[model samples]
Target: MARKSGKMRSFNVAVVGLSGTEKDKGQAGVGKSCLCNRFMAALADDYSIDHISVLSQTDFSGRVVNNDHFLYWGEVTKTSEDGIEFLFQVIEQTEFIDDATFQPFKGSKMEPYAKRCSATKITSAEKLMYICKNQLGIEREYEQKLLPDGKISIDGFLCVFDVSSVPSRTIEKQVEAVLTILNNLIKTKKPIVLVTTKNDDANETYVKEAEKLVGRKEYKGAIMLVETSAHENINVDVAFIVLAQLIDRSRGRARVLPFIEAARVR
Candidate 1:
């Protein structure tokens, strides 16, 4: 699960959460920003879990596969000497034009995982190459929007909610965001994970309600429902990792592997 060497890559992770002042009902203090830390290579300010970058994936048939690394996306809301509040984005991978418009992004964690699940009929290296090519295409799609002339191409989204918020209010907003992303940014259905933070405030009722809501909507891609706590490091890694795995599967690849990094000398 080491970072691919040679160059530093980044990605755009849609970290959509409530941000507000004390005047607002569902304020921003929720661990929304903190979850961004865990998703980006285990970057907890008070605590840490490095495994967020790599997910132990599997195929539908069921098989343990290689660890896939994913990028966390967001803008820097808070900054400190130790690190920063938002997920890191590589410049070249972004559509940053000038100081006024600094674009941030997260890298695709697919090529590695795809390299591991290649069908028996296809060579691993070949599969990896295919994944790389697709990723490049996705990046290109966003490249236009990266320019000022185009709009942002948000392929996926992560709706973060706090357990302390009004259950109905938070869940409602989350569902709305998912449907909007489905109809707008993405060309096809994409994976969406429901992330409820603050494990200490675990509400069984809220969890059940959230599940029912998702069941009713029925997203085309895989769905992961989990409660995580950046405060206690509870299932933090699993949440993000599962999202990455599901996204890789969305590409219609029943299996995976690589030709770029896993190419054989033969």
Candidate 2:
């Protein structure tokens, strides 16, 4: 049995999102960039982040290269034991658009017709799933087999999706995929935090869909809904602090003494 009493256990979390301009001019949206920036800021006290690596097609190699944010330790090479081990740890702290895929540059481009690239129609969820399966050695079919390593099994997953960029044709399925992943993950009895990556009212539809999914089903794990935006620094701190508390509680670690209210600052 994994010892679930270590308040001192350090965690290496990866906040995967888009970077670079719509067509690779190296400009990212305020919402996507801020989501991660704020998350790091909030966790700076309890945990130390190495560097925020901007993950893209160019940096997916199995090399420990320095990056502006965290060290961009490219894709996990199957041939290298060290690479696999490092990626496995990252997978543990990862919070992405979808529980299954990562495509960091899909929506960053201003217009799809611009660069005239291969034009791969990849959704945020599919992109993230690709990273997990190809880079992290985690496949949906084999996740169960990969579990039982004596670790707390991801403690929980917090997926932040910027629904505004979702394409019209596949939006419904994209949303459904998230619900499915959440339902499956909750079975582990770990807390799942579904965060809206944008604060605009335009995203209310997406938030509502997520809420419906959680409320319609009786999940074994705790579910939380938060609206996060990095530019204005809206609920970034609130989301992270909330997750930290959830993580602490789930691991059966520290608990606030009686009558000491857990501060809920907006």
Candidate 3:
């Protein structure tokens, strides 16, 4: 349900994680695309060759707003106006259009990243999915560019992992990395949601594994675990809805401005 109002806030949401982590890796057929489509409120059933390397944009009319589009990176980033332009220019200069080996689950999701690392393709040193700066512009720009990534601040994270795969150190690493950035680099306590994909594959054994995996840690806000299957359309909307709320909550949050405090002393 969309909020009925003339006013709305534009926020950027991104999907991120390391490769070979989706639904048993090398087994699932592009869960990222399916999840992205669902999260962005779109539907697609086929794989695309062009999706490899270059980022994809989709418009999502969120409950509070329209034109609430999301930018996806097989990895992710956050940037300012200046940083975003650099991202777009880099993409233009080094289009990821080449052959490469991707060891993860085979499909469109892995292709863009694979293409990015191709021998001939110039790759970005940092892993970031850029949300265009003009998105936060006054009115807007006809053309939008990606941000440089590394130093920009992110609002939230949606990490997708398979329920059937347990003892997933990879998933742990992914969570730690995002939390590390939010806590240390970005210095904001961003929200994180762990999405358990391929719910249909869950059995008694798998469910126990999933529970144990979730039990192992403490998270900010809440331990958000959403099970989804784009194939079955199970919890797909719920997962993203939770993500939206997290982003909203993040925006409503306020942090102490130490820099301002220091400047005040001067």
Candidate 4:
């Protein structure tokens, strides 16, 4: 359930990806961190595409090369024409471990590999819910009163793929990873958005191939497909806003304006 405070509604979205390793040559990293950083930076200041620093290929590949996860909070105070405001708290996770064996990844600058494989594991829907309730502090009041009440913890998911790496089998594996977690782990309907990152270097052939894959029956559950470029700030904000709107719609709430219109009005 959404935690509401006055006109603002808070949502927890999981930004999932398969971070590329050194083996994938010529393919920039999945760009999940870059996208999250760009969005959060926009939230903190004016939404300028050029203000944020760009991560070089070496830095992008080296940073977040492991299975570490991060949490980012952003608010879209821009009231829609319908007067709806949204607060989006996103968790950027590259792996999905089982709920029973989930442990938070603890890595530091001095010891980047400390407890890496042991701590960083994949997460299931149940595990994500557990993190939302216990770690992210989304619904403290509700949890205190109704501790065991059944409710979907995560509002939506942003399954990210590297558009530049779409030709590789890694894209298929990434898609399968998400489907495996969603279909086998916890059987609940949650909104999913297919996000292809690094669109600035997007290959038309690769992009078309990814679109074809998303059109398959297995990926029919994804409500939207956003092509984004975190380095160029292309559709970064729109991706989150669209997912937020879809989450609201999934819960049978009044629909908000499209991200373009809402952004313009703001």
Candidate 5:
């Protein structure tokens, strides 16, 4: 999708926890700082995605976007809400291309094939706009769904997992919950790419447990586990390439390498 043309300084993507090496000792899962760092590294190239600013939980001096939403990770506080909300705030502030110009694919490729389904045929991108607004709790208007540029509709969400740091028990439960969420969100048979970040910080035991979790899931075939690091500037590009593939797929362009390729592995 094209970017909106305007004099707006820049879009805001709050990499809440990904900008530093710090971690809350009490938290059990992957560190927010690490995740934010990796996420930013992966998405920085996209003109649509921007790192506006980070608001630390300890010190929140009103760095919220558009004076409404606060981008945050870790735990919810008065300063910020939740991880999902943090993402939505960024989306709300960003602008997309002309909302009226999108040409919905009309070919048979847009038809149901095998298990996958097609995009919405409704001329208006209302359904997606509603989900993005309400599901993420952006607190925007029911009518203000479309941005000035009109491309707020998201085809699907790509969840990047840091399996190596997730506790075994928590990992199992989170995986199940994620699968359920994805199954529901993609009810139209949309694709949800669940890619795993490469974690050298995790020990062998954690890796084994993550592999086991991957094995137990029905979506195992599409899961990709990468061992990369943003600090080292590791296979970060691969994630964006995968994201590009997803964008192409959304446009009815099928990719030959359906599986994780060797280049992205190392």
Candidate 6:
């Protein structure tokens, strides 16, 4: 009898976080968009993956038109040493709340939050657009079904928080939102990566506290923490790669380990 080959593993990763506002400058979000852009830019050069499709919600003016969400797609057809093939799709999301009513967007209303727009291919020189929101929306009834009860559509989540914004009430609220997601997924045992962004400007005390928070007994050592700096091109790729490995491990597939080691060497 001939040996049988397994199917390729595909994973959908949601980048969730709250947007920060600078009352003085009127800016939104902490650094979720930047981090996504950085990872996509380095995917080809650093990880040796091929770009499938890249899309965004922002218009020419660099503003998120129709208050929509953004989505970016990519894939790893071959590992560093031509190992098993893997496909990865990453989406950018924020807490969907109506600006005027200050209420969560639900049902048909959620459709516009991540409405697909013209696809854009990002280059190393081009900067990815950013949308500021208190938090990224992860659940949608009608959307691509990123996550739903049982049978787990979404494979993993990258919960990003700005280390520089720690101690602030807004960031604290963001952490609470993340905890809620973790609690919901506890039963599913889904892999999650707690990414601390803006590490280049992170406060040592805040970073230490963040580490301790993830180490709490409630988490049971399930979450992987990675400190990243999207601005300086820091551990952005490492965070995603780790999440991929975790997703593989959760499914009893350890084939991604070789690529991980290859990524570290380069």
Quote each prediction's TM-score.
0.44, 0.46, 0.45, 0.55, 0.41, 0.57
Clashing pairs in 5: 17-32, 17-33, 18-36, 18-37, 99-150, 198-226, 198-227, 198-228
Local distance difference test, each candidate: 0.36, 0.37, 0.38, 0.49, 0.33, 0.50
Tens-digit lDDT string for candidate 4 (72-169): 23333333435556676655644222233333223232122111211222232222222121223333432222111222246777767666754444
What lDDT tens digits, residue by residue, belong to model 2 across residues 54-80? 454443322211111222111221111
- What order do you get sorting by lDDT, best first? 6, 4, 3, 2, 1, 5
RMSD over all Cα atoms, model 6: 10.7
Candidate 4 segments exceeding 4 Å error: 1-7, 24-27, 43-68, 72-83, 95-152, 165-186, 250-266
What tens-digit string does per-residue lDDT give for candidate 6 at 1-266?
Answer: 11226555566676765532332112345566677767665443332222111223222112222233443333333232224444555656544333444443332234322221111221111222232221123212212322112111457777776677544345456556555545554545668787887777776666775677679799988887887877666667667767777877532233222222433644
Regions of model 5 farther than 4 Å from truth:
1-151, 165-169, 212-217, 249-266
Number of clashing pairs per prediction, in order:
20, 18, 9, 4, 8, 12
What is candidate 5's CA lDDT for residue 45? 42
Candidate number that wins on TM-score, 1 or 6: 6
Best by lDDT: 6
Give candidates' CA RMSD values in order: 18.0, 13.7, 15.4, 10.8, 15.3, 10.7
The alpha-carbon deviation from the true structure for residue 114 of candidate 2, after best TM-score superposition, in angstroms, is: 30
Lowest lDDT block of 10, candidate 3? 85-94
Q: What is the lDDT of residue 187 in candidate 4?
A: 36
Assess candidate 4 and give its lDDT.
Answer: 0.49
On TM-score, the leading prediction is 6
Please give the lDDT score for candidate 6. 0.50
Superpose all Cα atoms of candidate 4 onto the true structure and report the RMSD in Å to 1 decimal.
10.8
For lDDT, candidate 2 versus 4, the one ahead is: 4
Better of 3 and 4 by TM-score: 4
Tens-digit per-residue lDDT, 160-188, candidate 3: 55544444334455344334322331233
